[model samples]
Target: MALGPASVKNEGTKEFDFTARDFERVRSLIYRRAGIALADSKQEMVYSRLARRLRATGIRSFQQYLDQLESHADSPEWEAFTNALTTNLTAFFREAHHFPILAEHARKKGGPLTVWCSASSTGEEPYSIAITLCEAFNSLTPPVQIIATDIDTNVLNTAAHGVYPFERVEKLEPERLRKFFLKGRGEQEGLVRVRPELRQLITFKQLNLLEGGWPVQGPFDAIFCRNVMIYFDKPTQGKILSRFAPLMKPDALLFAGHSENFLYVSNAFKLRGKTVYELNQGGAPVRPANPGKLEKML
Candidate 1:
């Protein structure tokens, strides 16, 4: 007789039972720890990644897997949790319009301007920032510093390596392709790496935006936190923005994802343009002192 779905069993009569409740538990745990809210639609993805862990550990059920994750003292499961949860989609100069504006800002500032590429997936955005700064201040006295960060350590490692496949860099202009990148050769052919001079300007680190006490020493001239807030809900988004404001210099430029709207969030930042806001430290227009009062104004 053939086994039915519920009757299927393997390895000491333990049957695999993946349930919605189990999915909710894992999803909530991820959110509580990392602030990444997984949609109910991602249940299959959650099951697939977590199921691997279950098989590896010889565990039979989701509850047992959770128990192991909670009690395991030295396991790297926490890192795996973060890696599975965070979205890492990015590309070289993905948002092309932002670069020219960044270059213009660097030129106008004309000093040691610091730029932070928060959520710099796969290193493209930060390197793009570095390249623009180099082009803008080619002969200028001081140099720009680019600090790139992401929550996913896996991607940060890749970003720090600075090597990418040739197709990944297809959008780059030929002149830029020649000037800023070293084309890989021999066993590494068809690959490209950011040249040492450009790579020297950027420092990559892992950062979780929701975590308290950011390691960054800021007052950065411009913060390119683009395309990152889409995963967070309104309250979390507002909280993150408020924390970021105090760390910026007065009149520092803050860039957000194209899809994000700060209207419902903190009013401490003044709208400069589409997806760009200026944090008012002293002379610029200030939002209400109370966050509740600011919400009314919004």
Candidate 2:
């Protein structure tokens, strides 16, 4: 039967059939594809986005549409399915404190530096890192590169464009804002783009944290995987941590979400402070019982 524009609810029930089984299926598919384990509570969100597709295609039930999706792997509907479910909440310098710490580490190291923004949603975090580097080292004599990655292809494309609303640029200081961003004009009013210099410093790509054999080379000096791990299960978190440990330099720094802690994950790194970890090089490692005692060196 052809589906109408109105949302479909199952017989003798308040919840849509799509709301029941499809939600769980979508959640499983997301975890399998992107390693993001969504809570069962997000069923409504899944229903809402998928229901839009149903209306657009005039499909009556989620079951019929899901069958079509499975059969037509190359369809645009499949692509939309992936895009709609991913979260893309990010801001330039969302956590301002991390940038200064990163700057200090880069300046202290004083040579070729490679920084990875592992969960760089829409490119804000990595660009912030690049700006901090530019501010720290007045000259670009020493080579530095920022690698920004996200699992969502839609956001990666947006990030590579480097265009954002003017409001997003307002977070920067006036001088830095003028220096780093170009105000959109004429047809592009209300949008701003990162200057070529800052944009050039970042390499954006699509990467799934759950997948094996990372596409980019590492031995990175620092990595910012902030606010991304809260969606993962502990086992997945542990696996990701183990994978990152070998990719980092001996004294490399790892930064995680404020809500995340690595104490139970692994002993590969010593806690330096809240959500900050220092790779245990040759020195004796000291594990702090509480994050409070660890100094914020930056």
For model 1, the stretches where C-alpha displacement exceeds 4 angstroms are: 1-16, 56-58, 72-75, 139-142, 281-298
Question: 1-32, model 1: which lDDT tens digit per residue?
Answer: 11134331234433467765676677667765
Candidate 1 has an lDDT of 0.76
How far is 245's C-alpha from truth in model 2 (Å)? 0.6
Stretch of 10 with least lDDT, candidate 1: 289-298
| Residue 254 Cα positional deviation in candidate 1, in Å, after optimal superposition | 0.8
RMSD in Å for all candidates: 6.5, 7.4
* Residue pairs with backbone atoms closer than 3 Å in model 1 (clashes): none
Q: List lDDT for all candidates, in order.
A: 0.76, 0.77
TM-score of each: 0.86, 0.84
RMSD versus native structure for model 2: 7.4
Q: Top TM-score: which candidate number? A: 1
